[model samples]
Target chain A: MHPPRDGRGPADPPAERRVGLILFWLYVLLYGGFMALVLVRPDLLSVRPFGGVNLAIAYGMGLIASAFLLAVVYMVLRSGR
Target chain B: MLHETSATAVAIFAAFVLGVLWLSFFLGRKGQSASGYYAAHGQIHWFVNGIAFAGDYLSAASFLGICGMIAFTGYDGFLYSIGFLAGWIVALFVIAEPIKALGKFTFADALDARFQSRGIKLAVAISTLVVSIFYLIPQMVGAGSLIKPLLGLPHEVGVILVGVTVTLIVVTAGMVSTTWVQFIKGSLLVFFCGVLTILILGRGLAENTGSLAPQTLTVRPDGTRLVDGKPQERGHDLRPVGTIRALPERYGSRRETGALGPLAYLATLEDSRIVTWAAKKRVDAEGTHTVFTPTERSGADLLKPGGSFKGLTTGNLADRLDFASLMLALFCGTASLPHILIRYYTVKDGEAARRSTVVGIAAIGMFYVLTLYLGLGAMTSGALDPTDTNMAAPLLAKTFSNTLFAIISAIAFTTVLGTVSGLIMAGSGAVAHDLVENVLGIPMTDHEKVRCGKIAAVALGIVAMALGILFRNFNVSFLVGWAFNIAASANLPALVMLLFWPRTTKQGIIAAVTVGMVASLAWILLSADTFEKVYGLSREASVVPFSQPGLVTIPLGFFVLMVVSLLTARPAEHRA
Candidate 1:
């Protein structure tokens, strides 16, 4: 079986668990903010597709959003620690 | 952009290689024992290990390949960044602590911790080698590609140089020097890439994009020209001349008025139209080689999906599923990679592993963000080499200043050095620690094991060099996708099952790993993409139903493990 929740085995609250949770929210907020920007100015994500999907816009937005999300998680984990 | 090689580049390249060798030799003293050589005695500093994670993780595919892809294909390239980073979440949340808690030296140790079985050892060792070699190819290929432009050396020379240097590093200090070298390279790559991105954003975009001078075209053995009806070169004789035209852009009012800012570049492209490759033909000795050539596409045509997701535009379920499967492979593959998994062993504890991963994600994420800007910058820079997409970023740097070009090239070379060292170390560890010592029961002293590892390191280095030379023309990033697919299919199931599943027997682990590895390998070899790209055969002839095997092979591994464990459970208990 697993260890008790006093920072042992996989069951305990990791010192950084709160930090991870906070980071997740922070990422959502940041991404939300970016999405707001895109909504306000749709041009930011606009790119002329070169005969197909404009992967540039798709990926660029994806990265920004993902980075913000990752940062949120990282920050949450850090704060918890 | 100038084709001339710089004195600064040569000096930097030489110094970087020499510096690595110096560090290796200096650290060679401590790596005398097998544990010290393989895992740095599990005492590396957290910060250093974190950066080394960057080094081990960031291969030529990340540096040259991703940047080149972005420069050529735009956002499609940055998908790699997402896939790579997402995988780390799995590493951090799932694999990190448990792996550190379980084993040492190699990935096989963790899986075999609960049960001691020769079958498990052999299976994991084989999987490790297969993954390591698949991962090794792009590094070697990128090394060769970088050498051609940086030192003006042939592709084979670069491959041999990397082989020799990485072999020296692994043979001398094993993980210690490899970690340090990776740490240094990782730090410099991110720092320099950040600097480059700032420069790109600062410069923004410009109108009348300066066109790249045409690359020197090769004469086909069939006496045909790649361009119009030009005369073919007899023998190896050739002349450098500019021929290809830069595709013109329909300058919207914004671009016509003045240079574009970062946001304007993307905005204008969305509003205006750009020409990209569609399809073209070239005559060669084998026959006519049909390749995609970008043309001016607009409106709905430009909006449609191409390449891997060509059917996505039609909203077909199967096409969407294929796309999702590709992304799934990429996302999970990173954490499951053998080279990456073994990196956790370099640190002192689970905390270090976690912390280092954070640093890696930060550095790697920042660099990837910069890649989008750099890629967009190169796309419009008009400095892109039509023939050599790999040179996009460095060539873009050359447009601004020759010194930046030199530094970027040198750093790119170091990029190859850092990743190749990690792969060799992983490969060598499999041979020495996993196969020979653990599986074969080769009784030897620690020092002897270290010696054997170094010998294996040299051999693997040679093999990487040969493959690098052979697969010089294939896209480094594309080849990396195959690596990830194999890694995810073969390694992920075995790792996750071993860690989470209680009934997972040693026999089950072996069967899953063996079946997963073989199934994935066979699928890739027989896939339509492989048939067309590597074997130069008709796609219709391929037996594999899908180009990617992860969706099938991964689940198959889990099934095998479940069935095998249930069948063998009582038999094993009776035997005991």
Candidate 2:
């Protein structure tokens, strides 16, 4: 990850930065939750969440869809600011 | 096993290639200056570059390799897709804007902007070449794999064909042509894959044709095939095999699920019984013959994680660590890739870079979701060539129709060309821009600089072709893991420390990059996978304890940087 050495871009309020960081970590956690399931209990992933879809497949698809969702949200937040 | 060469597939492949080359030549005139050659004059719109980002990032590994892995193994392949897309989060949050703001032409420019040190330039340039070359290997290999069935040529010829073609593309226009090529190919790949997934959902899953007979393939001492213990004549290929033996039995007459929705498809397959291929090679005094045996399995078991990576199951400590190490590398590697990072420089500003990244994540994420269907469709398609899992997707396309197969293969080929061009661009920039201009203190005009970059591109293409031919047997995704590991190990620590740590010195960045690159490279060269697969040696003789080194080398890079920086930091009173 490229670390910004000094701020040279659009400045954001402290509150916005805090919210962005929180949301970023929350997304990471959402991903981490699936991975943790894979590590600790992958069998749980095979368990069906609904009629035909299992937990692993559902959560995996969710993780993919949510990446797009979160990216749109982040962009919206940035532009809104 | 698919040896039939369709005339239509060849015609389509040629036309698509000629069209791409024509476009490259047309755009090549625009980027004559140094900035234009290197960064597309920073004139690319965020949307176009964003889609190009998808094109550049979605190499053969993502499209062909991941699909093949899922087609053969199952959910394990999707793990690579997830890890890859997730890396953009780090890119979006940490790297995107700064990369655009700090750098002029190449990845080295951004890293060396804050430090005018020649040491940093030399270190970063070498690391960029290493990462780019590593990434190029799998793309070239994927190219070779596609050519075998579509063009009916040897794998080496396919490598040479693509190497020459991409070098021509890069020599013509540099980044401008590369960007447009990527933009076009990226759009086509996603669009066609969406079409193919729809076709799969429409066709639905079905039972294997007629009887569930297990086909046995035996090679005689003379290399002739024996099917079911009968010696068949040479040049006759075996039939494609893989099928669903027993269905859910709820259907009236025909024992197949007619049409399945995306979700229902997986569920129905999980509840049914399927026959998958398993091969065992036996050695005699004359030669070695592989027997393609069928193993009856429940679809539920096949849909789980243990098929490809034994780590998720069987409870082996080393395997588990290997899996985790690979996932970590993928997560961290995306932002660190030199080619991926340089795309940000093609945009106008920091905010454009950020916007482009979000667009990329959307495009990439959507395509990855489609991969699940594509791969699963290929899995039960009964068109699988049991010998080469890499051929799964294209072969699945052929099962539908020859015309679709040709189109998909052509798009897959373009995928390789686009990715390889980006890699060559990054490598050439490292050599010409950073290594020569900055590190060696060479003086040259903008025109001469572009010339130097073009020459470097040719040399890098030659190297890629050779490596591609050497690593033909390995899957593209597995080869990509090595690239990701090296990138994450070498670049991530230094980039992160330079931004966050006030005590970080030029010596520290140089040290971290060198140590990380060498350590990871050494680990890979000595690892069991390399010993067994690359070197044709016994795994017991391998030096490294595990195959993956990210779990060790990534943190090791940080530790080395910290220690070296502390030792070399200038006195506070003397600091700027």
What fraction of the true interface does each of the listed models get right, in terms of native contacts kept?
Answer: 0.04, 0.43
Best by lDDT: 2
My TM-score estimates for the predictions, one after another, are 0.85, 0.95
Q: After superposition, which runs of candidate 1 have C-alpha atoms over 4 Å from their true positions? A: A1-81, B209-218, B222-265, B277-281, B284-294, B298-308, B314-319, B571-576
Candidate 1 per-residue lDDT over residues B1-576, each given as its tens digit:
125567887887788889989998999897888888989989998788878888888788888887777666555576676666666766766677677877788888887877777788888888888988988888888888778777778889999998898888888899989989999999988888888877766665544432222223434666454432344334322222111122226543334424445555455544444444333445556556444344444322332233224544455554455555666687668877888888888888777777777777777777776776776667656566666667788887877888888888878888888888888888888888889998889998977998899889999988998899888877788888888888888778878777656566778888888998899899989988899888978888999766877878888888998899878787655364
lDDT (Cα) of model 2: 0.86
TM-score of chain A of each: 0.40, 0.73
Model 2: how far residue B84 lies from native, Å: 1.2
Angstrom error of the Cα, residue B408, model 1: value is 1.1
User: Where does candidate 2 stray beyond 4 Å?
Assistant: A1-20, B209-235, B573-576
Worst 10 residues of 2 chain B by lDDT: B230-239
The positional error of residue B523 in candidate 2, measured at the CA in angstroms, is 1.1
Give the alpha carbon lDDT tens digit for every residue of B122-222 in model 2. Answer: 98899999999999999999999999999999899999999999999999999999999999999999999999998998988887754455566676777
What DockQ values do the models have?
Answer: 0.13, 0.46
